[model samples]
Target: DGYLATFDLDEYRAVKGGVAKKLYRYTNKRLWKRHRFTIGLRSLAEEKLGFKQGQFESELARSLAAPVAELQRFGIVCVIKQHGRMKQVHIAKKMKRKEAKEPSAPVPSLAKKLLDRGVDNAVELVQRFDAERIRDQIENFDDRTKNGNDVGPGWLRCAVENGYGFRKGFKPSRIVAEEQKVKSEKRRKAVADRAREDAELKTQQAADEEAFAEFLKFRNSLSENRRQELEDEALSKCSEFERNCVVKARRNDEIGMFHQLLWEQYIIPTLAED
Candidate 1:
């Protein structure tokens, strides 16, 4: 395999000077693989640049200033410096200005969809890639899986990870598609089951809250002595560990709060059972 350096040909053509042109070409070839490098001037002049005659290292370095400045205008940054007795050229491409990214507010909805479709660690994936990229992958995955023969969460995850449709000339194999379809169905079912369990838990919590509120009103309406008797009865029904909690609360002067807890945890469930 060989390294590939890509640049705008028009931009390359517009840069002035032989030194600048060769410097641009050299940096472009390497900068794609690495960000920065330092090359000794003698080797750079003789081996890389192919200058007609040998010049003093300092003279060669000074000559590079104009070319380096010209190259800078075309997106490369270069500096000539002395290292002991040798002159070295430090080179790197200028970083492009990044456009402001859209905020991550929309990530949750996109992540949820991916989660339902059987992508594991969906939230992390969404956060890492951002909503726009994930959305693009989703569209690509949907298009690929439209035939519905081998389709599932695995396929979608693979599509997102590999950039199946978006990357040039890359597609998932038939075997991979079939495997993903099978795995995705299982993952989707698991996700749906968890969603159902969560909904049931929330519904139960709401019902419990309503029941507790009703019981609180009834208890408050009782005479003070009757309320004390009801709290004592509930406390007696609690486990030894729960009893210790109440005792600790009482010591901390949070007895009233613990009494309410006793009613909610013990009395409420007993009332519901009856």
Candidate 2:
């Protein structure tokens, strides 16, 4: 038994950004037996790479650079070359020298599942098809194949070919789309909630500012004697320690500080009631 590591549809789909999918498809279709493939840059752009018409060679090369680098991370190497008026790309898979090894520890989960269903070439089948799709087919086969029905690998293969899971009114793509929609709705709701909270905070802040301004105006309109009486009433409500602090401020000739202390102790509370 030997383990072979290859990227399945899940890993391929998980790769994000910059024409990686196109690059993968192109390389995958062409580089199965051969290690290298050469294609016209213009043809690759228009056909496989999905670039728009009239794109210059420099632009295509620049765009291809990123995906080429990305594919390199997945063991594919690319070389771009210009020959007179023709620009071509060489796509190659990096090969490692094979050496003798010990027996594989255990079959992978997907292969094991295939084996349980009586597939002699479970490992080959796992490598050949999308793992998730295979798993889906296996589940569908299990559900449909009852005690009397055929529960063999042949039935499973037929189920996979016909896409029994999709035929049962549920598709993997549809599920993914629905999940994305739910996530998008949650994000939108979160943003709306944040905006509403911010607006409410600002409105309350404006109302508090207006009320404080009115309080200041009403106090200024009061006669000097009346204002002094109100200040004394406010000071009476203060604790002994607070009153001592106010006295110390007044003794230091800090008139602004003394007024602020009185406003906090008395005027602000009266304004709050109004």
Candidate 3:
């Protein structure tokens, strides 16, 4: 892997260090900055970590400046983003806890083998490996099993459960799509229901209009004396229930309103005014 190093001193000393000697392409510092030579892997080992380490590392460097300057080894983790969502997914095992004295959490680091996969924008994580594959490699150890030292998957779980990890929001596209789908379905069902009710109402109205017209024609055809005789005959054939309904509707009500269900098929004639 190509290496460009940095140090804390009167100024800062950043030069080729560690595995940079292994490659002829990395023989000079000039080649290290070139995009072609830079395509190869970089190291994430504490001794070999570069400025390109992610936001998590940057936060760590800022938070634990004292411990780092003391050359105290510590663990670190990073949060990444992919596809417009934040993913606080740990990749490999780093030093674990930021401070030597702190409990070891199940913090995965970007391994030296996967250094090139690291990105400066923690929001855009390198997708070279999936979370499941990386997660499978983590092993959680019990406190006492490792002699009261927090290490492994168990520590990671504890750390995350205690609020050390990142949580992401719903994907914007997915949420919008689902909301639109629900609205469309509701609109479709409402339209269908309204149409059905309108059709039924129109059919009933048409039937009522036809019945009223038929009754008017029948009444017009009969002379007043004949209509009265016919009405008397019909009333005599009616039940006590029908008689009572007619009495209740004696004023300002349609003649058809007093008809029994069985008599409804035939329209009732309206009597001519005296």
Candidate 4:
């Protein structure tokens, strides 16, 4: 019978004094919907029989027949939704049963018997069933890919959410390593580019400093009177042109010195460390 049931783990724990620990227990509603029938049946069994679905023996099923039938007759459905370590079962129909016999205990109640076995049995069953099914689905995934069917993004996302694709194989670690390699390569390239730019600027600065030193040396070698005579002669050779060129050259030297001092005080130490 088609029915929907939502089972909440917290509520289950409050009743049973034990928690659901399977990875699949925390899966979202949409993923659980893939096995909606199984989930609903399990929830109903828990609710009506005070036994987890996996513990639903033939006798337990028989015990719950009346309640199941009543819901079925009323056209009400049960939906089960599981979150991590929690299960919730939503019943759509209201059965006309007396308050006294209306499943007096909470589903999977923490009576002595349930306390002894319920938690361990429920967790084991869920883990075993879910792991086997996930393994089969992964093995068959290649067939879908070969047929040009992309497993929708949602499918992959669900697998990741449920922790199915990794830990089983070394694939997740491999992917992480590859991503790290790419980032490392990008960082190296950026550092190289910056270094090249710094080298070019340094080379230009050194050339300017060397030329200025040579000019100063020549000027110092001459007597003051001889240097003045040479300046007057150069000015006389080309009046406006010489004056303009000399003025501009002096201005450039002043600007270059300012930049050189700034680099030495701030930029050079940082670049050298890198």
Computed on alpha carbons, the lDDT of every model, listed in order, comes to 0.70, 0.70, 0.38, 0.43
> Candidate 3, residue 24: CA error in Å?
32
For each candidate, what TM-score against the reference?
0.34, 0.35, 0.34, 0.26
Model 2: residues with Cα > 4 Å off, grouped in runs: 1-7, 96-274
The digit string of per-residue lDDT tens for model 3 on 96-167 reads 222223113322353321222221211112143444333322222222224553333323333222223222
Candidate 3 global TM-score: 0.34
For model 3, the superposed segments whose C-alpha errors exceed 4 Å read 1-172, 248-254, 259-274
Write the residue-wise lDDT of candidate 1 on 73-172 in tens digits: 5568877788898888888877642332333555578887786666655776776675666777776666556644355554665556545554344343
Q: Which 10 consecutive positions of candidate 1 have the poorest summed lDDT?
A: 96-105
Model 2 weakest lDDT span, ten residues long: 1-10
Q: Residue 228 lDDT in model 2?
A: 72
| Model 1 ranges with Cα > 4 A deviation | 1-5, 97-274
Error of 2 at 227 (Å): 52
lDDT of 3: 0.38
List model 2 lDDT by residue over 19-42, tens digit each: 887888678667766789899988
TM-score of 1: 0.34
